[model samples]
Target: IPTIKLNNGREMPVEGYGCWKINYDRVWSLGSWLFNDDNRAGQVVLQAIRAGYRYIDSAYFYNVEKGVGHALRYAFRTGIVKREDMFIATKIWNNFHRRDRVVEGIRRSLRDMGLDYVDLAIIHWPMGFEDGDDVFPMYWNLSNVPREWSRNGFVETWQGMTDALDMGLAKSIGVSNFNIKQLKVLMDSSKIKPVVNQVECNPYYNQNKMLEFCQQNNIVMTAYSPLRQGYDLLDDPNLRRIARRHNKTAAQVALRWNIQRGVAVIPKSERRRRMNENINVFDFELRDDEMKAIDLLRQMPKLLTFGTTRSHPDYPFHDSY
Candidate 1:
């Protein structure tokens, strides 16, 4: 697997496995209905490791830290991937964005995941939620966050993040779902710049500007939802045609496209076959024309915007970037 060099001298795998939407409720989905593997998330983590994935992406928001931890421990115990070399990335939720609560938040994530340190610790979002025991939103609570809290909270939270890095809680600290403006704030104020920006990016929502900007600024952008879901993006005539040209799935082409652009991808898949296919993007490259054709479909609906929190002062969805 290829590695992307970050600002802090850290090398992250260009392709990572995402551990989101783990299907804890066992809802009637394709994976559960088709495979009947109830602990599909954990099972796939093990499989992903074997399939050549060195990096794993998860977050407190995903609520599957215990399961992810268990799978990782299992892999280590079985002599698959060594704990010291594996790259694990997790994040701090909005509720913990307060400067005072930042350490507490990441500590909880570490405890839940049972990890001593993560390779990367990201600020899940730019917004800061109400100071409370619960991390999830119960109702619209824009007021739960202070009016000037956005910039101030981010600064303070970043200070705590720097502290965590200093203490070796995480090897690298970064942000997710942050736009260029927020990044500018950090660039202006902090001594340690963010190494990566994890965002909703794919062929449909290519995030071309963000990718270029991060590269120019010495920040690597890790892409989540890197694989487009549904038939339109994956099964479209042009993408399908391109996939066939390379003897790859549309999903593989999409993942490869990101790596080709010097961006990292964390694609999620529960099935063993699909997991292998997702990481197999390293074997080929998309033609320039094929890449442009997929980029033309940049209008597909986004996967995770946290719309209910849009009213918050720090909500990042409204930005053009």
Candidate 2:
């Protein structure tokens, strides 16, 4: 696997396994068990590592770090891989943005993942929610904003993240779902700059301007939903045509496009075969025309807008990136 050199001098894998929506409770369902062939997040993560993925992306919101940690321990015991080589990353949830709560948030995630330190710790989103035990505090519906918002600004939350770095809880810290303006505010106020900005980037929502901005600032841009989470991009005729030319799946082509653009992708999948396919794009390179053809998809609507939080003060999608 290829690695991207982060601003903090850390090397991160360009392709990674995303553990987002792999709910621990849902793994017991018949569909999950049948397709995944493993009922635990650890099993799935183990399968991913076996499939040649070196980067594993997880988060507090995913609620499966314990299972993921179980897999990591098993892998280590069996000599499948070493902890230092595997780039493990997690996020600080919105509810833990206060300077005082920041250290506690990462500590909880570390305890859940059974790790002394994470390769990367990211601010999950720019917005800060009511600080409490609830993940989505006062969130009763998806279509409306939450009832309460945290008074803690992202800068304050970043101060807590810096503390985590100072205390050796996280190797490097970055942000997710932040826009240009938000990035500037944090960059201006803090001495340590963000190494990367993770967001929902795919063919439909290309994030061209944001990519340019991050590149100019020497910040790597990571794509979380690189495959759009479903068949929408895979089924497109243009993408399929390019895939056929390269003898790769549309999913591979989609991922390669992001990789060619210098963006790291964390595509999630429960099946082992798909995991293999996702990490097998290093051999083939998309031609210039092929990349431009995929670029035509920039107009497609965003799949994960997080629009319900549009009214929140820290909502990132409100700006035109």
TM-score of each: 0.90, 0.92
Poorest stretch of ten by lDDT in candidate 1: 27-36
Report residue 106 deviation for candidate 1 (angstroms): 1.6
Taken over the whole model, the C-alpha lDDT of each candidate is: 0.80, 0.86
Model 1 CA deviation exceeding 4 Å by range: 26-40, 140-152
lDDT of 2 at 222: 99
**200-298 in candidate 2: lDDT tens per residue?**
999988999999999999999999889888847789999999999989999999999999999999999989889999999999999999999999874
Q: Name the 10 consecutive residues with the lowest summed lDDT in model 2.
A: 28-37
Question: Stretches of candidate 2 above 4 Å error?
Answer: 24-39, 139-152
User: Evaluated with TM-score, which candidate comes out highest?
Assistant: 2
